[model samples]
Target: MNNSKKANYSIKCTVENCANHCGKEQYCSLDCICVGTHEGNPTMDQCTDCKSFLLK
Candidate 1:
């Protein structure tokens, strides 16, 4: 039996202010890329802020 637990991986920003659509390895827009860097979360894989984040 497999006892290993599967990791629920998902993209998430650290800015806490941005609302961009972060995917497993992609951002919704370029703005999110900039903001993610400014917010000290430069990790492209883990975006947290984005200027082009649309609130829907």
Candidate 2:
């Protein structure tokens, strides 16, 4: 994982374990992120997920 990369301020992230997360910063390193929901009809924040996340 290259934590030296610059943060994409457009996407704020706090999941330090994600490969796309900006090191020590509250932001994502990717230009964009994919968002998805496990539930067919998502009704809560918990139902939504960061589909772009990859294990670091």
Candidate 3:
């Protein structure tokens, strides 16, 4: 049996809307962290207006 453990990296959400302070960046199953295309893209400012992110 392989019992290797996976390393996890946590990202703290500075966004006031989100209740969770610290969470996994890429490992978050419930929430997804992706890159933005434009300079004003909300996802780029994860701690500001992530709710306005437009996924393409």
- The whole-model lDDT of each prediction reads 0.38, 0.91, 0.34
List the pairs of residues colliding in candidate 2: none
lDDT of candidate 2 over 1-56, digit per residue (tens): 67688999899999989988888888998988889999999999999999999998
* lDDT by residue for model 1 (1-56), tens: 11232222343443323334433323242322334445553556455544455553
TM-score of each: 0.21, 0.91, 0.25
- Segments in model 1 whose C-alpha atoms lie over 4 Å from true places: 1-35
* Top of the candidates by lDDT: 2
After superposing all C-alphas onto the true structure, candidate 3 shows an RMSD in angstroms of 9.8
**Reference-based TM-score, model 3:** 0.25
Native-referenced Cα lDDT, model 3: 0.34
Ranking by lDDT: 2, 1, 3
Best of the candidates, TM-score: 2
In candidate 2, residue 22 scores what lDDT?
80
lDDT of 1 at 8: 23
Worst 10 residues of 2 by lDDT: 1-10
| Reference-based TM-score, model 2 | 0.91
